[model samples]
Target: MSLVARIATLAQRDAITTTGIVLSGVWLFLVALFWLLAPGGEGTQGGIARLVVMVGTILPLVLIWLAVRTARAIAVLRAEAADLRQRLAQLRDTAAPRGAPRMAEPEPLAEPDRQPRAPAPVPVAPRPLSRPLAESRSPAAPAEGRALDPVDADTLILALNFPDGPDDSLAVSALRRALQDGDHARVLRAAQDVVTLLAGQDLYMDDLPPDPAPPAVWRRFAEGARGSAVAPLGGIHDAAALDIASSLLERDEIFRDTAHHFLRHFDAMLMRHLPDMDDAQIAVLAETRSARAFMLLGRIAGVFG
Candidate 1:
């Protein structure tokens, strides 16, 4: 167990013990005072009466102590259980799949036309593409010296979701191309910052199952809709997630700032790109990890009413 958990458990035990002792002491003191003030009749009958009184008072004290101890024990068990669950979540997040290559080292970006290999088992850090965007003859020219394609909606979605692992060649390639564009790179970097921040608090976009709003609702949000009209787009209603996010937004300066930055970039991206996308494309985009992060953070940031 964590040191904080251990300390909390010990504190609870101490409180329970102290309360039990105080109650028992008070009852004993009252009983002794009553006995002194109003003595019983003499001899065997008196002695029997005193013995009965002693048992009566002591029995209740014992029972009360037992009840308090049981409650404290149960509370401690619950605390330990919660602690175990949190540790398990963290372990699941950090553990790489068996036989998956470690992606800690940087690798070259794959060609966009090349067929993607097996999905990678880990996320790779974004690296500079071989050819810089400046090398392109025109604004629409590809980042590579050859005729590279423009960043399409599908590529943008893949880049937003980010590569799941080292073998996620498609996503990695998309990310590489997206990073070459200034606007796409800004949105991508903002999304990444917020995702990392959320992960630090054990909040993952994949774990949050958002309510699936229709494409119309997303379109409305993409426009200038706000308040109740765009509220449906803020579909992430997980109570634990909302509570954690709300708390962080209220208390953590860095988290609050990152969330707002992500929200701004996402809103701008939607306004700029949503017009070119069909309902199907919008739906697909909404399902991406980055879009999910946008929904979660947007709701917390009050972007949607």
Candidate 2:
């Protein structure tokens, strides 16, 4: 690629360092050449000699700093790429079929010498309840037959971003640092890091040029109507739904924290599948999970429905 394209590509990850390093290299070369050719000393232009001396001394240091910064950014991207590759390999291994290993034949048991007496038969009482109390009190509706609405799906997509909300993650704090430093490259890289973390969990923003939500639903959402946000999000449990969920969480601190809690709690559930979690903690996590799912996929239109 051409220099511009190369710089642009690097800009996505470490634009400031990339540009600075290039400029510093050129400046260092020009300064060094001028000093060598002119021999900046007595009988030379005082201002030119002073400028050459200053540039000659500072450019190498600037170049070194830029090079180090670029190297560090490249290292971080490489690490993340390695991690992604590892996860993909793991998934592939899990999905791939494996052949059963061969086993040795077992020896047959010898027959008993004497006849053994049979135990007497005992009658057992039938169980009192056929089902659990929780199941009996609240029956779940059939989730498979329900269809997703276009508008609600769109709203779920829109909910993925919280442009005006504050972020709670360290990555966001780094993003702020990049912004304060006016480093577009670092800013974009930091933003990508945050987005990747969300995407790893299958959350995404559904908005693109064409807009995924129905026009009517979009209007209602844009107008901030109380009932326009309702959608049947409970049934949306796949990676695609995660995209929309992630987008919403990024845009809204409340949604982000809620999603964070849901993910961490669900992770805990997986780790503690043996039912070792406290009843209160389980109840809270379960309720949060259910509520978040409902809000994301439920069919009640409201301000935050």
For model 1, how does the per-residue alpha-carbon lDDT over 16-92 read when each residue is reduced to its tens digit? 88888888889889888887899666666677877997788789888979988897998799779778666644543
Best of the candidates, TM-score = 1
Q: Tell me the whole-model lDDT of each prediction, alpha carbons only.
A: 0.69, 0.35
What's model 2's lDDT at 258? Answer: 42
TM-score of each: 0.55, 0.26
RMSD each, Å: 15.5, 22.7
Q: Model 2 segments beyond 4 Å from truth?
A: 1-41, 91-304
Per-residue CA lDDT of candidate 2, range 74-132, in tens? 75566555655565444333322221101112233234236432212211111121111
lDDT at residue 100 of model 2 (Cα atoms): 10
